[model samples]
Target: MARPVTNAAFEALLHAAGYGNAHAAFARQLNHAGRNYGTWRYDAASVYWWLRGRRPAEHVQATMAETLARKLGRSVAVLELGFGAGEGTGTSIYPASAGQAIDAAERLWTTLAKHIRPPVSGTFDSGKALQAALGWRYDLPDKTVSRNGRQPVTTGDIQSLYALADHFTDLDRRHGGGSPHTRALMADFLVRQVALMLRGNYTDVVGRDLLRAAATLSGQLAFMSYDAGDHATAQHHTTVALRLAKAADDRLHGAHLLANLAAQAVHLGHARDAARLAEAAIDGAGRAPAAVLARLYTTAATAYGQSGERRACQVALAKAERALDRTGLSVGPRWVNYFGPAHLAGAALRCLGDLHLYTQALRHAPDAITLSSQNARTRALHTALIATIHARAGDTDAACDWGRKLARHAVGVHSARVEQRVRELTAMLSPQQALPQVSEVLYALSTVPAAT
Candidate 1:
């Protein structure tokens, strides 16, 4: 085993923040700042352990930095405190500014392009995620986005970027982002092509358009990372995308990115964080198109459902329904064109399923499956969800039937999300393995390889 190295930088920051050599004071401050997250019990001993080279939990690190930043009257990033990789180094979940966000995205793409795995702390920071959402909700738009670089960006270049984004989105929906080869290709494209375009010269008008397009691409990459079960990368990319959207003054896209983060939070079992993020997205979505509003509302419903707030979930679902009813009144952005009745139904299914209203959830499954037929990953997820609902409802035969369908749809798909649903379904049915139908479904699922 390697010897633990003391965190000299942390010690320096501790002193600079006026705690000096007093670990007890810093511990008290940390506990006070941590109250908003949850009840945290920290003492001088905890601080001593950190000083002795033991890393604290992710949320605790965030709270420590936040407390120090308050005392020092300046931003103190966790990386600066010698806890982990900071936003400047490209491992922090969110960057501090639009410029830093772009740089972080570039660094990440370049690293991935070289087949190097970026550093992941393997822990989700709910506090940091919530902070990013709040920032997106309240931050002022960038005054100007004009830049002078090696080449002049043109309207044609922006259009090509949009087209490339569409291409990648389609590919992700069809084959999922679980394949290492596909993810590498995307990183290479961003590094070799998109990075230069972002750095190229342009007017504010053109730059805003470029930023919006880039945000779309980055958001797609974020979703792809989520589908592949790389939560840290997904969170980083989502934060970068949120910054790009803000710089472009695109509140609608920013709201969408927040919703994505909310979904990721729900997946990671951070229901309260997910609820707060979804609420922020909805609150910041001013005068958005009906489709966008519907998506946001549905996302909130899912979060609320997971948090066990049935009334709030129902209200959100109703709002989603109202928005869908008015969707024909206006045109939404091309990026959100995927939202429709089927998408709404799928969201409702997940929300209701989480609430254990299995019958209501099952009502939406057919439409979700049929409408999402072209997207193998979506179909697989819905199928597994339906199967799980059936199993949970004590319908073994029906569950096995849906399980067989999931097995069919899940083959050749590279999606951790899909695999997760399958695992859930199998676990739900595992008790009835003696039954022939259950045994058959289990055997079929066994043939599917684990997602990369």
Candidate 2:
């Protein structure tokens, strides 16, 4: 490979990530910190990949330009390093014609059929060097590295992939969160697609971008499995997501995956495990915008409460508030735009209600309910919380009235968590009241699981 000459491309990436002179700045930071300087040094091979649009590890890339900006007392974009447009001397990874997109997809799938899956093994600690390169690390090794027997990857398959992933996302949103059937389909599909992407040939830059997109999709699929109560399937999808995120070297996606896993852990009653995963997500998100940080920390607090760590839970909640403040200070990423003050307040309020801090929970409840979007599941959850609060206050009439409403709204909705909340409210109804409200709620509860 030639010396990294894609200064223009690198600079563009830096600009997209909101950095200037990232590489030089990173080097200076290393020197100032008396850390390993080589990590900051980009080689010809790395530069070649970068020029083609390949990204270094996420933190490194951001830090690289930020590093130079600090030292220079001014800013320069990472993409401005040294890049030029293709000279029109080689095959096009992007199809030149509309027909080529389809041709490329088939060729990609076919070419990917020949590679073997990576062998599964016990967990291993990737050393500091690799961790730094990957832009993530943990004190403990809690993940398994295994192969799911997928096909090889090939050039031109990205368009097909884009189509397929998009279709699945729509289906998921339409049919309900990842149901068991959907989760199974997703795992099988991902195993095949991911295998091909791993083995297929592509320019480093193209591959990195594709992997990043794929990772996000895979993580969502994993979440579907968790929603369906298929923990093993969810874990497998999560592991794949982590691998793809690493290949893309995008920490934001990785952080999201970890957060998903933590949510799964909490659902499974492994609160401590969930807390650890949440902490890892926060570490990965590093300096993410306020909206994103708020989302992450809110999740952390939820997990902390699950683990019975009251102090830890409040501390994380406080952090979430601080992160939300940053949204006013800086523009947030698109993926996190859905996270706003209302979203945070709602979730925090619900958590408080769950923890039985009724007054404080009530304090945030009205605001959260008011701010809630058209998210049916979230609305259902809030309704359940209101029911729970009424029950706790010994208002049998109000409790049963709200409980019936929650149960009816939850019907035909494919959410176990929602069902559980409905059950919780039903359980709290006072048999002594014998009110018609109580009977209506009890009738609804008869059809749902008793434990939930």
Candidate-wise lDDT, in order: 0.82, 0.57
Clashing pairs counted in every model: 0, 30
Please identify model 1 stretches exceeding 4 Å from their true place: 1-87
Candidate 2, position 209, lDDT: 62
Q: 1-452 in candidate 2: lDDT tens per residue? A: 44444457555654554444355443345445322211234544444466566644322433455555665567744334443222211111322221222233222222112121111212211221122223334322213222222333444666676667667655543334535556555544554455345434555666666666666666676565455554554555455556566656677767777777677666667777677777878887787877778888988888877766778888989989988876888887444655666667766766676577777766776656554334555566677878788788777777777777777656555666666777677678856437776777788766643212
Question: Taking the tens digit of each residue's C-alpha lDDT, what string does model 1 give over 91-140?
Answer: 54556566776777776765555554444455556787788887887776
| TM value for model 1 | 0.80
Best candidate per TM-score, number? 1
* TM-score against truth, every candidate: 0.80, 0.61
**Lowest summed lDDT window (length 10), candidate 2:** 116-125
- Cα lDDT for residue 295, candidate 1: 94
lDDT of 1 at 311: 98
